[model samples]
Target: MPSIAGTYKHYKNENFDEYFSAVGVPYMGRKMMGLSSPQMDITVDGDQMTIKTSSLMRKVEYTFKLGEEYEEHMPDTVLKCVTKIQNDNEIITESVIPATGEKCGRHYLFTDDECVITLTHDKAKVPAKRYFKRVTS
Candidate 1:
């Protein structure tokens, strides 16, 4: 498995607004997210990993292990989440709201200098893609 331990800065996105809307993010929140550039830092230590996402408007951090369930506090709702590694350079995360049965997921594909993330909601067939370049400094 590829070690995904680095900082990445967002550069581009595709269909993020629509995906956010489908997941119940308010218009103003979506607008702010669209206008802001976010950075993600990931650290891997054996079977545990920590992921931190930050932007001008919001920031959050999460620590979890592969194939384990954890509580994920999102902007809209809290979800029970699980993560898995798909291949040498890809990781998949699935989250669901127990009270509402709402489901969402993210797929991260890493290259030498960039990571492409895909966001998906169970209610929406179309997914969104975000591109992040590694921060070498």
Candidate 2:
């Protein structure tokens, strides 16, 4: 698998507002998220990984073993999540909210200089894409 342990700063997004709305984020939270530029830092050690996402308005962090289901603490809610790697260069995280039965996913495709994140929710009309540039390798 490709190692994606790096620091990245978000630069652009597409359909994020709609994606957040579909995922049940409130208007104010979505607005603040839209205005904030998020930075994600990924760290991997053996079979475990941690991803820290931070922005001006919010910050979320997850540490889990690869391929193991764990509780993902999101800004709006908590979810049961499983993270896996695909195509050697992509890391995918799928989540389900037990209380509401809501589902969402995040995919991180990484390269030497950039990382592209794709956000998906079953209720969304379209997927959202966030682009990030690597700050540290």
Candidate 3:
């Protein structure tokens, strides 16, 4: 299995706008997010994992222990979330939106070349995927 700790840059996304819309983000917010190129730095220390995401809009960091539930406060909303790894191959994050009371999921598959993030919402017709290339330097 590939190591999950790495620095990654977002290069492309599929159905990004639609996914944001289904998640209740407004048009302008979605547009801004679409235009931003974010970088994610993931690190693991013992049983805890920290993910820091930075972009033009803002930077947010999340730290959680594997298979443990936590409260994540986002810019627009709050989520009840749990993150875990599957067979050491994929990082899975499951969350519940407080406002909508809807369940969502995010899957992160890591490889030597890149990491692909798959986002799924209860209200969305299909899942959205974001591609991020690993920064080897």
Clashing pairs in 2: none
Query: Whole-model Cα lDDT per candidate?
Result: 0.87, 0.88, 0.90
lDDT of model 3 at position 33? 91
- The TM-score leader among the candidates is 3
How well does model 1 score by local distance difference test?
A: 0.87
Report RMSD (Å) for each prediction in the order shown. 1.5, 1.6, 1.3
Best by lDDT: 3
Over 1-137, each residue of candidate 2 has an lDDT whose tens digit, in order, gives 44599999999889989988987789988888888888999998988999999987778888999999999766557889999977878999999989889788899999888999999888998999999999997
User: Model 2: runs farther than 4 Å from truth?
Assistant: none
> What TM-score do all the candidates reach, one by one?
0.93, 0.92, 0.94
1-137, model 3: which lDDT tens digit per residue?
68889999999999999989987889999899988989999998888999899998899999999999998887778899999988776999999998789999899999888999999999998899999999952
Q: Which ten residues in a row have the lowest lDDT in candidate 1?
A: 1-10
